[model samples]
Target: MSSKKGGKSKFLSEDLNELLNESQFLKDSVSNKKITKRQKNDVTEEESLAKLIGQYQANSKKKKLDVNVEACKESRQKILDVMNNQLETRKEKSNNLLKNLSEVMVQLEVDCNAMKDNEKKLEHLTGAVVKCMQQATTAHRQKLKVLKDIHASFKKQCEEMEMDHKTETDKLAEELEDDIKKLQEKLISETKRSGWENLRRTIFHAMQNDF
Candidate 1:
């Protein structure tokens, strides 16, 4: 989430920088326009003064007019005053623009610093994420190893149990065979006793008499 916010802030910063550049461009254009207007005003005033001088020369040649001389002087003084005032106004305006431009430059520097800081922060976050991922991978690997060991142990236990069962079954079978052998021996001995021999002879004599 922090990473996403950082990305958005970066985008907004870039946009703001672009807007600042456009604003500077517009300000420069406006400053140029003002200078051009000032120049045009000066040229128009000069042309008017030149025409007035020509008219005064023509009138002086045609007749001696005192009132026209005073008017011409006053007109020249007024033109000078207007020119000086306009020059001062232009100079003041240029100074103000320069001051503003300087301030804009400072702001741009600050924004650049801010962008650098944000980039550093992002790099830090990326490194942290990488570290976390590595740790998780390591943990998972360890868990898998543990599980594998457990499985191997279980398999070994199962084999041991089966071997024990086979051993017990073999022991029981041996004991049963021994018991059957002992009983068979006793039966054979009883069948071959002295009483059984006497009975066999009696049965044979009886059979001869009947014949």
Candidate 2:
């Protein structure tokens, strides 16, 4: 009975050692699983951070493109406005030049008409002067002809008067010479008669004394 009790106690000690070894193995497996799960969670967090960074970069690039497009549109509108203003100014200047040209053309036409009228007047005046000169020359020729006729008539009258004067002088000279010859003959006859009468008277006186 003493040997059998000692063998049973030894058998019980071996069984208790086996249970302790099994419990240690289970604790080691639980620790290894916990470490693997913690590693997986860390990898998932790094992937989520990478996705957020990519989204932020894409949004920034889009905003910059939008700003550049808006600036380009504003610049194009300003250029168009300036070009339109320049075109309007040039159009106004062209209209003013056309108006001035029209005014100049009107004045030139008026001046040309005036010159034509003056030329016609000058031609008329020249014709009138020529006509007057011709009339004056005709009148002067007629006057000269009349003067020459008067001078010839006066010369003929003077010649006739000189001939009548010469004839009257010759008639007076002949009548005076005949009257002087008759007076001389009458004086001679009277003297002879007176001498004969004186002698007869003397003889009569002598005879009366003798008786």
Candidate 3:
């Protein structure tokens, strides 16, 4: 009985020691696994911090680019507005120039028409003057011919009157000369007869006285 008890006690002691050794091994394994998991968690935390910093920098650059693009859009809009205003001004100027040219053309056409009318009037006046001058010349020529004919007739009548007056005076002078000659002969005969009768009377008277 004593030996059996001793053997049983020995067996119990061995089993207790085996169980304590297994407990210790399990504790060590759990401790080692905890350290490995802690190391992995530390590495993951470092990688996460680095990725967050890089993302922050990239976001800042993107915001700056977006601001620059917005400013460019605003500038482009202002330039377009200025160009539109200039185009409108040029169009107005061109329209005014065209209107002025049209007015000038109208005035020139009116002046041309007036000049043509004046020219036609002048031509008519010239023709009237020429016709009047021709009539005046013809009348003057006819008057000169009539005066010449009158002068020739007067000269011929004066010559005929002079010849007739000379012939009548010569005939009267010849008749007067014949009458004077006959009267002179008769007077001489009478004077001689009277003288003979006077001589006879004187002789007869002397004889009577002597007796």
Candidate 4:
């Protein structure tokens, strides 16, 4: 609304300036001289009367024109005064709008700073999460290595136990074969001694072989 009023006021001011110039031109035209010479001899009364009437009409027109010019000048000044007032009001309104816009700009700056801070905080949080993930991954790797070592140790113990069992069984079998050969020689000698001795020797040989 203020802009509209300002536009109208500016146009009115321009028109008044133009009208003032026109008024000045009309005043100049009214005051300009006309070149004329009166015939002193044989000038008829009718010609004089006609000339006077013409002068009167001319004067009347000039008076009317002067009055119109004065009225136009006054009207133009009134319009100018009104335009000046409107311009002042518009200027004040424009100043107020500029102040409001400046305040809004300040608020926007603050909001922008807040957004930057939030972005910084988000970046920090992202970095922390990444660090935590890295720690977890490292810990998992260490734990996996420990578990692998434990499994390898248990497998080695099982292999050693199996080798020990095989060796012990072979040694026991050899010892049993030696004891059976000794018992067979003792029974053959007893049979030549006596019948009773032979029976005793046979029982002794059987017990030795069992051992």
- Candidate 4: C-alpha lDDT: 0.51
The total of clashing pairs for model 3 equals 0
Instruction: In model 4, state the lDDT of residue 5.
Output: 50
Q: Which ten contiguous residues of candidate 4 have the minimum total lDDT?
A: 33-42
Per-candidate TM-scores read: 0.32, 0.37, 0.37, 0.32
Q: What C-alpha lDDT values do all the predictions have?
A: 0.54, 0.50, 0.50, 0.51
lDDT of 2 by residue, 129-158 (tens): 656655554565555455446545644554
Of 1 and 2, the candidate ahead on lDDT is: 1
Per-model tally of clashing residue pairs? 0, 0, 0, 0
Off by over 4 Å in 4: 1-43, 118-211
Put down candidate 1 lDDT per residue, 70-144, tens digits, no spaces. Answer: 454565566556655765665566557556655655565565556555655555577776566556555655655
Which candidate model has the greater lDDT, 3 or 4?
Answer: 4
Q: What is the lDDT of candidate 2?
A: 0.50
